[model samples]
Target: MDMSVTFGDDSVAAAAAEAARKLAEEGVPRALADGDATLWGGEAESEAAIRLGWLSLPITSRELLPEIGKLVERVRAESLEHVVLAGMGGSSLAPEVICASADVPLTVLDTTDPGQVRRALADRLDRTVVVVSSKSGSTVETDSHRRIYEKAFRDAGIDPADRIVVVTDPGSPLEQSAIEAGYTVILADPNVGGRYSALTAFGLVPSALAGADVTRLLDDAAQAREQLGADDEPGLLLGTAIGSAAASGRDKLLLDDSLSDINGLPDWIEQLIAESTGKQGRGVLPVAGSEPNEAGDELVAGIDTEGDIEVHAPLGAQFLIWEYATAVAGRLLGINPFDQPNVAESKENTTRILGEAGDGPLPTGTPALVDGPVEVYGDLPPHAKDLSDVLTAVLQDIPDRGYLAILAYLDREAAFDVPVPPEASFETITDIWAAHDPASLQGLLAIRTDRPVTFGWGPRYLHSTGQYHKGGPQNGVFLQITGAVTDDLDVPGKPYTLGRLQLAQALGDLDALRQRGRPAVRLHLTDREAGVRHLLAAAREV
Candidate 1:
């Protein structure tokens, strides 16, 4: 099993084979390889025309090798060996997998949580070199991170230009500002979108600095390039199988990466699949980091796990393959894979909420019910008794064929210090959730329902599956978990603090979900640790 995808020999596989045959006859493989925007019809042309740059990344990204290597050597020579990646979504997710697979340590700051940001700021400030990456350069979270790090570097008597490297599109705001600031700037291909940019500078820069063999990663991707363009190839078969299954009502994609040599690939796949195809109220919902169950409306795929629809690949090729397959899947779903129209709803709401709030505290509404350390915020039934009742109501609200999304806007690394049992372990929220019903809020809630459960750290998922929750199908009930920031960290030049930003983001997304008439419940942990314990206890009761 090497950089290939094999479907089952049953009727399901036969149907997929037929879909692939039809697609090949329709010239999908060749058109996709040729970067033809017309493959997705007229509506997707403008975005698709540019977003297809990922197809050429394997060949085009190699030119950055010499410069990146030289930069790494210079940084290490200056004793700046600690690589802190200040990026969100595609900027952060790919290097995480690369560094994890290479067994190298890379501190990825992709959160607005005060504790998480403070933790990153406190760690190895002297030897740290921050890689600030943003495709659009206007991402609030990344911008915030850049500002704080610049302040920290300046306060430490170190010039930010020597300690910071910027990765953005050639003319992005960050690039222009970084050039003026005298910081090292690495321009990503302007043609590629954030989620589809694993092979671009956004992925390569951070991983190379962290001592990963990024050159080998590109080499592996190139090896699979020719195969992806031909009929009956892994990319074609995979795209058609998953796409057609989804078109036939199996819209929930159950991804299992347990047997893969690639570390933390599912999250990347989750963002890729969810953000790309999840729009126009139609998309494939990627249910990753869960115990794969044989559900009626779900398609279970394993990365290197020998079962139905077996997918095996090097981490590099894995990124390219899944990306191409997702594009094909989007074609079948009749949605633009390149555009994320609904993702900005939350961001716009956040901005509006923040702007309206100004320096004053964000509007805090009364909770529907206060149970122990937890304050439940939602339109729950009036007769509901306690937290368990709220849990029951939320779980019951999940319609048949619907899924549960637990979006935690708290510090993602809050659980990093805890110990895991020998059977399972995890590095970060970017890593997979333990499938063995581990003592987690998601695991506990999962036991109460049979529907697919997904866990995402907020602001991070805002760039990933955030699109799906708003633009995808209506069959999703969200459980938003926000916690009280014990010690808030203030952003250097912003009117809002990190804790406030996190809360506003959570509230903004909640408002958007409610506006869509989606069933959403917000549980605020007024006492972070105690609330977590009580929430878990209530989930267990349910």
Candidate 2:
């Protein structure tokens, strides 16, 4: 692994070294290895469930190396052309990362957007194997994706059982469903939590299906495992840097990867560090996917692979390294890295709002479209004019040590009712929209404000950064942008439409933020594309 670190100040480095020594003396690493939850200031029984599962992933992955190889061989024998993983958060991120280097065509459906869902099912339903993955097997998004695809497969005169695979804990509802439906079922370890299951079946099976070199990946992970107990282990050193930096007033973590071939790795790390440690009024803010030159109270780390090695080696190494570093960071932050307590609030709220849905008009407000490109909605303070004015108003309330969080409830891609032409595949559409729109919004916000700007897509962020916004330090100024869902789809076993469900989640989170007394603004746009354009224009004006 070709990894290096540099601190903005010598004092920061000295403090990190001291902290690493103290942590070693206190046996933090050993406690983590032994599955002791004592380092976290909480009842042991309460935190015990999440501690041990991730601790053994590196070793377990190595043990399962042969099994992974056999599975890949079986997949090849079956002549499966594509694999679509229907999962969210932990269940999805690792597969997406591994598939970046995959030879087999793999698509991960983590969004409930009807258009994206349709695109995933448009052409590949025949020779494609759908992997329905959820640790608990009951995630709404995962189950919903499975239901939609199953219906599509059946309608197309295909036997869904022959083309479906289930990845979940034994006896999970999804596992039982898969068994009853005669689908291939691969039971993940029951103890491993979703976010920490990168090295477990949740990640490895997909890696194999994608035709990745699982043996080499496991070899790299095994190397990372060997460094866990050493005093100067790379994982520990990085963790110490993160822990000490946050403790010394540099809580904003700027993570960048120079490896162009690997995408979404930073997003995975963002969830791991943010959701795990962002609680009890202190957390580390991971800034990824965007570049901000101003490093005020921020720790910047660049992750690069050695030029001589294959991408999978260092990529696999990163999985173990970050997992261990985050555990160390959790110990230093006095929190349990395994459990996400606040993640359920938005879910429950969304369910309640859906249950209460009736003929009532959707909860939406008009934005004030003044000289700016986008309109402002919700409570826009007293004198805000356009979306930019609303952002400027929100900026005024940011504390000296605070950051800006741009939360978008807009669909990641435009919705389509008809099947896309074979000439223009899902990948083509993604490539078209890849460079424009919200991709530049982060840089624009960073250049406009001194405070660090973090961007998160809706409902998805509800599972990732939403935990931090509510449970972490109240040093965030939230600007939530929501737009009209023109083509809505129904979620199976739910009372509301997918569009309505998304709206409910957005409203639920916005309400939750306000209830916490955090400074937040909601902007409702009539047009999604225009809304983004106006948002960028507003950001530039600010």
Candidate 1: clashing pairs of residues: none
- Root-mean-square deviation (CA) per prediction: 3.0, 4.1
Task: For model 2, give the 10-residue run with minimal summed lDDT.
Answer: 304-313
lDDT of 2 at 36: 74
TM-scores, all candidates, are: 0.96, 0.89
lDDT of every predicted structure (CA atoms): 0.87, 0.74
Q: For candidate 2, lDDT tens digit of each residue in 1-542?
A: 55333455566668767988998898877666666766666653466555567666767757666766776677678777788888888888788887775544578787766656766777566777788888888888788888887888888898888788788988888888789999878877777777778888889887788777777777777777776777777777778888887887888887776664556688888888999888889999988866655555777766663211112327677887787788887777777777788888888877777666675766554544444335565556667755666677877778888988888776565533324556998787654454345656777767766778898877778778888999999898888877677777766665666677677888888878888888877776666766666676667888
TM-score of 2: 0.89
Tens-digit lDDT string for candidate 1 (95-207): 99999999999999999998888888888899999999999999899999999999999999989999999999988888889999999999999999999999999999999
Relative to the unseen true structure, what is the Cα RMSD of model 1?
A: 3.0
